[model samples]
Target chain A: MKKHNYSAGPCILPQEVFEEASKSILNFNESGLSILEISHRSKDFVAVMEEARALVLELLNLEGKGYQALFLQGGASLEFLMVPYNLMKTNGKAAYLDTGTWASGAIKEAKAFGETVIVASSKDANYNYIPKDYSIPTDADYFHCTSNNTIFGTQMKSFPNTTIPVVCDMSSDIFSRSLDFSKFDLIYAGAQKNMGPAGTTLVVVKEEILGKTGRAIPNILNYEQHIAKESMYNTPAVFAVYTSLLTLKWLKKLGGISAIEKINEAKANLLYTEIDRNPLFKGTVLKEDRSAMNATFLLENQDHQELFDSMWKKAGISGINGHRSVGGYRASMYNALPLDSVQVLVDVMKELEKNS
Target chain B: MKKHNYSAGPCILPQEVFEEASKSILNFNESGLSILEISHRSKDFVAVMEEARALVLELLNLEGKGYQALFLQGGASLEFLMVPYNLMKTNGKAAYLDTGTWASGAIKEAKAFGETVIVASSKDANYNYIPKDYSIPTDADYFHCTSNNTIFGTQMKSFPNTTIPVVCDMSSDIFSRSLDFSKFDLIYAGAQKNMGPAGTTLVVVKEEILGKTGRAIPNILNYEQHIAKESMYNTPAVFAVYTSLLTLKWLKKLGGISAIEKINEAKANLLYTEIDRNPLFKGTVLKEDRSAMNATFLLENQDHQELFDSMWKKAGISGINGHRSVGGYRASMYNALPLDSVQVLVDVMKELEKNS
Candidate 1:
């Protein structure tokens, strides 16, 4: 049976990426060595690292724009701490937009460094909408925000114009849409979403924004050190980076973010249209702030839950169960999810309405 | 031709592990979903995380010893910074044994926390041997050392008896040998060595030793947070951990460390004996401190370099090139490296002498 995987980040990557990654595990690049067994410093793996870094910049259209792309480990959670360590000064504060769980998590880590100012938050409304009209403190070292809130199904359609270096955690929506990526000084994403698997985090940082923190930073957390080492400061996640490169190559072959954005929009629209039109369900977040990558919806009547669940399961649709915070379904339409899968989900929703 | 991979940390794993891991990437556990595309929170993956953690303690004989095993990212290098962050108090000092490159790296990170006392160092001899006669400071918060030095090809024969907590970076030789295991309060190994792949790190620490540091530690760097979350404080390297679990299962089927220890010792002895008997070759590190996992050797006569290099390449041997620190050959025989592979290398060395 064909499975439509929509379980948020670490969700779905291209089928071809999975096939090549699987084959590489047995014999990487025809080197007669399992990808898992080869050294990270090996010429073959080094090319993988270099190509992955270069491809990330190329896909984001940030090539030759003073940005260095690094595939580091520990996911975006580590980036939360590293951002403050490498960017925030000895006594300087950081302004953050508390959009959702991840944004607030970043703010929590930044508070450990120095003063952290929350410019705006939609938590009072349970993070169902993107909070606009936020004022960035000019004196702050940097402004931080989450590009997409996976759990709440909210996304920042437009970023705030700020002079201070902007750091965006694009963990869930990166590579899913087209944007002027150079506006952010640092853009980070845990590669589980639209990028690749779950082991590596992609960090794209402008060279000029680093080394001004004025505090002694640990070499592991310092962005400049990683750049100098060419992301081989220590042994990187070789297999994860290689798999990411495969996924990035797939994305590039599919014509980059601009091309995927159109397909993603179609998938999201197909699902959201059914949610708005069908009498059985309604969208979760405010329509304007709804995430194209993840569409959250709820049953108009709770009695239809069992019928809806079984119908999707019978239709070979998996991972639409909503997060604990929101008691509904979330259909994550990442770059790899086909429009046909979303249509199958729409049909399931219609069947549920008829049964109810 | 079958290749004998000795790439040193991210070296060889069981061939069966590679086959199974490769299959899982396409469809995990008959679930019809690529392991790469599944959520880390899924029941199947959660089981993987649980099994991998349990298997680490089980294989190490650390079960019921109040030791918590965590699969983390950023390799042992990140653990260098984290060890200091989570262990060393605000005003506390740490005692370290500077054995080789990785040990010195750990000591360097410890210096950022507070006073780092170097009890002993073999730097004068280019780390050719482990400095054994050293007194760990009684007042120090903890004692740190590297169990095996992959670069210099040396291993600590025995650990120092210390009342203070002991921390060891067993990255290159964790599962290849049998140890008291409880002697060290914390043991961290990057999974690329004898375990699985190069994405996740295995951190086994005694539960009692945590929360002693008085400094405000970031939650991301906090061991307590990871333990509380069952090593899923963030999105874990899902595929890496699952593959590691597969490797650990293979080790268990091979009768665990004590059984593999005999095989590892035999493989090491087979190659070391040939190195000793052959007139063309000489071992790099001191005889008494030579590592069983990684054997660093040099040509007694420089003229044999071309002949030996060509001979090994023709025999389907790879990754024997030594690190720049040691200018020669390094045959890393991790647990998964069969005795037959070492015998093939030994035959090549004998052939070189015959040709010479």
Candidate 2:
């Protein structure tokens, strides 16, 4: 049985992407070299890096618009520090929205580099919904927010238009849907979720916005340095980046982000409908703000927990167990997740409802 | 004929390791999930992280020691900055030996956080030899040096026993041979060489040595934070670390570092002897300081360069080309490189000599 993988990041990648990547691991580009053992500086892997960067630009429709793409390391956690180190200047204040754990983590790192203000938050509501109607400070250097909260299963339906530069942590829902890519000055997504594997972080930065921060940014942490080197400032995560290129290739074939958005919406709708309609289940988070990437839900009747668990297990479903903080289920409908798997999950939920 | 991989890092791994790792990418632990897509927090991957950490200790004979092992990202490049940020106290000086390009790069980052002194340097001679007779300052926060200059093919003959904490960038020659595990307070190696791949960096630090530096280290760059989180202070380089575990398992099955050291020595001796004896070739670095890992050589007569290049190419050898800085050939004989492969290169050298 083809199991539904919903364990969040490092989560589901396209099957063909996995197959192609596995073949490359055996012999990359017929070089008789495993991708895992090839230098990041080699011509073969260099092509992979170039293509990955170009595709990121194409997918975002930012090519020639002066947005540079960088595949970096240390994941989003590292980017939390890097975002501020590169953009936040001396005495420069950046506004951040504290939506969930990840946003809070980013805010914490930003505070170390310079002054950071939490302009708004949903913490009082336990981060069950994305906070909106927060005014951006025009004097702030940038506004930082997470597009999707993986743990909370809440997502910003639309980005706020503002005069100040905007930096986003789009780790969980980056390529799953289409967005106005030009609205933000900087965006970083850890590749574990919708991007690729777990090692590389995709950083898209406006080329002109750098170097104004005044602080001597560490070469590795600086966006401008990474852009100048074309993301090869150091030995990059070769396998991760190569696999990302493959996944991006898959994404393009699936008609890019626009097409994936429809598929993602369908999956999310199917699952959410089941949870809302079924007497035994209830969807967490506000319906308007529920993520198309991660859909969190719970059993209305806690007594039916064993039945729900066994049903999903029997249906060859995996990774539907929600985050420990949420304590229910989260059927992540990432781009690669087919509607068939969502149907299987919905049927299981409906069966539990009928029996219970 | 099978090609001999000497491409430096992500250089070569045991062929079986590649095969097994490729299989896992198809289906990890029979979980019907690709290793690339598996959740890092899952039990299977958690086991991999723990095992990789344990194996680092076991291979170093540091089991039950105060030293903690971390598989991190940003490679050794990030560690260059991280080392200083966490350990270099305010206005306190640390000593460094400028050995080669990488060592020089490390020096650049060290200067960012605190005072750094270059105690000795081999840069006077294009870094063809490791600097010696260096005196350490008793009051220095740490004495730092690169144990091996990969591009120049120079290896440190011995570490100076010093009272101040000794930090070393052992990126190239970390596991090729065994050493006294207690010598350095902190040692970081990029995994592309002997360990595994390019994304994850291996950090070995003594627990007692941290927090004495008296700096407010950022959570991500702080060695103590990484220790507290078991290197999960962030979402780690998952595939890189898992692949590293497989390589470590292979290393352990082959009797750990002691067993691999003999193989490494044999490979280096075979290649270096040819480089020294062949009329068409000459070893680049000082013989005593030559690395068992990367053996750099040049054509004695530039007129015979084509013949030497063609001979190696015909013998199914790859990645033996030296770095662009000092170009001729750099046959990086990492631990996974077999004696047979080195012999092929040796034969190629001898063939070039006869042809010339």
Candidate 3:
């Protein structure tokens, strides 16, 4: 049976990327050394680091724009602490929009370094919608936000047009769609979601926003130091970064973010349409803010749970079970997910409706 | 030419470990999923994590002991700061032995969290010898030491029998020797050297030594939080940890540390004997404190440098050029290095002497 992977990250990456990564692990560029064994400073791997950084910028359309991209160890969870540690100015408050658990986590870490103000939040409604019509605090150090809620299935259609520096955690939906790259002062993502594997974090920062905090940042956590050394100050997540580069190349070959966004929307539309019209299920998040990345839904009748689960399992679906926060099912249709797989799920939904 | 890898980390791993790791990256345990794509929480990877943590305890002879093992990101460099953040009590002092670059980096980070006292140092002698007969301060929160200096080729032959908690940075020499497992309160090692690759740090902490610091540790850096969560506090370095498990399994099959130590010592001795007898070279560290992991040496005359370098390159030696701190050559004889490779190097040294 062909398995449909929806295991929200360390999720689906291109089959070719996996092949190339596997081959490199055996022998990297004919160097007679496994990518796992070679030093990051070796020219072969230095090329990999440089290419991975360049591809991150190229895919984002931020190339040659003074935006530096780095691949560092510690997942996006650590970036929650580092973003505030490096940018939250002394005695100044950073404005945050708490949309979901990840956003709330970001806010918690930011509060440890300086004052954090919740300018807006959708947590009150179980984070089913992205809050709007909130005023920006002009005196805030920066405005931090999560672009997508993976659990509750909400994504920001438009970002705040604030005057302060804009920091975003785009972990789950970074390369799945097109974005206005210049608008963000800093962006971070755990690689397991949309990028590569779980070891490294992808950090893209506009250089000028740093150094205003006046606090001495730890060398390993300091973005400026990492950029100065080109992300090799400390030993990096070499295999993870190399695999990410391969994924980026595959994305580029598939015509970059704009091309993939169309496919992603079609997949999300397929699943959501089935959920709405099938009568057996309903979408979880607000209709307008429904995530094009993770299509979350639930069976309308609780008694149908065992049947639905058994049917999905027999059909070879993986990771369709919903998170504890919102129980039922979540089909994460990331970039590597083909629309055909979504069609399979749509077919599964139709079958479920027919049997009922 | 067949390459002889002696690069100081992201260094040599067992050949069989590399092959097994490569196979798993393609299809982990016949799951038809790349190890890179599966969720860390999946039973397969959870088993990997549990086995990895258990293997660390087993290799260190700590099974059934109270020490909790964790695999984390940001390498040993991250552990430098985490050690003090989690253990250095409020307004308390931590004592550090200044051995080499990594130890100095550890002290630099520890100073940020609490007062750091350098109880002993070897900087006056260019770090050629491990400082001896220094007292560990009893009033200090903990005493920190680097068990092996990768750059200087000096190792601590014996640890201080101190009453306070003892912390060790064993990045370069772990799994290559036998140590008294019950001696230390905390031990952290970056995985690139003898264990595995570059992204993860292996942390083994005595459970009772934590929660005394009173400082709020970030979720990613907190020791107690990681142990409580069984080291899946976040998406760990999945590939690195998986690879490390394979290496540990290989170590166990080779009869664990005691057997590897003999092979390591023989490799070190083979190269050091040539350095001592050959007219062109001389060993760097003191005889008593000489490292079995990294053997640093110097050419007696700079005029023969080009010929010697070309000869070694022709012999397919990689990364023999010593670090700038200690000029001439270094052959890092890790657990994975076969004695035959060291014999090849020794033969080259003899050839150079004959030519001279």
Candidate 4:
């Protein structure tokens, strides 16, 4: 069966990246060594770390302000704690925008460290839209926001222009679009989304924002430790990093984030248009704040849910089910997801509408 | 050139394991989805996590016990902090043996949480061998030790026979030999060495030892939270876990750890015998306490260091340099390092001797 993947994370990747990454895992660049076998500190592997970091900066367009890119272990979950542990020390209060489940998780971890003031919350409306018109606390140490809500299929289309530093968890929508990164002091995301796999976390932090926390953060959790050691503080996930570099390389060859954003926008627009035009389906998230990364919808007649599910499965479409927490259908169209895959889903939706 | 990989961690894996792992990275289980592109919450992925967990216990012969194996994102570095956060609230000091770098790291993190005692330390002699006649403090909550010292090339031939809880970091030499796991309350290892890769950490813990900590641990760092959720507490390193399972499956097919132990013993013996018999090279660690995983050696003439290095590199051997802290050569004969590679290194030693 020909499958079109719409998984939220551990999501789609370029074919060249997959081939290049797989070859390295087998025999790294013909070094007669598997990327899985080499020490992360070795010259070859160190070069990989360097290139991966360099490409990340190139993708972000923030090259010269001494921003450190760390490829650390522990997914974004650990970063939720570490970010607050390191950045939430001064004034003991940080402003957080409660966007969805992941944002709530970050807020919970930050609260454990100190004070967390939710500047804005979308929970009142079941997180169908991004919250608006919230005042940022001037006394807060930093403001935290989840750039894109994976479950609710909502995104902060434009970041809040605030005086306090902005720390964004861009786990799902990172690298899918270009943004003015100068607006963020810290940006973190798990690689499962648009990067490579699920082992590593990408942390882009302004060098000046760290070292303020008086708390003795464990070495592994401290971004400063990884930054000082060039992400080689301990053995890194060599294969994941290698594959990530390949993905980054693929992104670079495809004209970087600018080119990807256009493709991503096109893909998302195609699917969402199909949802709005089709009577059988109803899009879940607010049209104004609809996510350009994850397109979620539901069958209007719930009785046909199982039938629609079976149709998609037999059509070789996978991971289109919405999060169990949300419970309809979610089609995550990440950077590597081709337009053809989205078109396939749109075709399936149209066919379902015609039969009905 | 044929390379002999001796990178202590992120070490060698069987060629077959790499082949199988690489296939999944491109197209997993013929699902036409890159393993990197699948949702961890998907049924296919949940089964991978379940099988990987099962395989770890099966390899350790820990089935039917009250033990649970978790595949976590943070490497053993995070375990240093998590061990204390999960089990240190007994209102008593945790007893730790200072075997080497990693053991001391655990002790440092434990001190941050509660009272911790350094029961014994091999550091007095530069951790060249395991300490003997260590007393487990009477009121200690747990006795922690590092099972194998990757840097110092030492091993604990036998564990302390005590009624108190025993926690061990077996990152360097796990599955290299049969272990009496009955004595261990918890055992964790970073999967860079003899296991699989570097991103995931394997933890086998007795379920009853947790939830005693009164202090609130950050959710991501809590073992009890992970156990209750069956290691899917968050998005895990799915690819690393799958690869580790492939390695475990390969281990089982080769007749489990016992069969591998004999092969490991022969590989270590072959290298150590050459180091002992040859006048050009001298083994670093004590003969009795020599590690079966990494065998360290130093040349008699310091000037010949480059000569030895070039010889090995020309023969396609990489990562043979000893750690900078200890200047010499370390040939890490991990589980996947065939005895033929060891013989090749021995042959290099003999060739060096003939010229000298």
The lDDT leader among the candidates is 1
Candidate 4 backbone collisions, by pair: B10-B192
Candidate 1 error regions (>4 Å): none
Which scores higher on lDDT, 1 or 2?
Answer: 1
Model 2 lDDT at residue A6:
78
lDDT of 1 by residue, A199-305 (tens): 99999999999999889999888899999999999999998899999999999998999999999888888888998999989998999999999899898988888
Worst 10 residues of 3 chain A by lDDT: A17-26
Put down candidate 4 lDDT per residue, A164-202, tens digits, no spaces.
888999999989898998789999999988888888999
**How far is B251's C-alpha from truth in model 3 (Å)?**
0.7
Which residue runs does candidate 4 get wrong by more than 4 Å? Answer: none
Rank order (by DockQ, best first) = 1, 2, 4, 3
Q: Give the better candidate number (2 or 3) by DockQ.
A: 2
Q: What TM-scores result for chain A when each predicted structure is judged separately against the true chain A?
A: 0.99, 0.98, 0.99, 0.98
Model 3, position B110: C-alpha lDDT score: 85
- Tens-place lDDT per residue, model 1, B234-308, is 999998899899989999999999999999899989999999999899999999999999999999999989999
> How far is B189's C-alpha from truth in model 4 (Å)?
0.5
Cα lDDT listed for each candidate: 0.93, 0.89, 0.89, 0.87
Ranking 2 against 4 by TM-score, winner: 2
Q: Enumerate the candidates' DockQ scores in order.
A: 0.91, 0.84, 0.76, 0.78
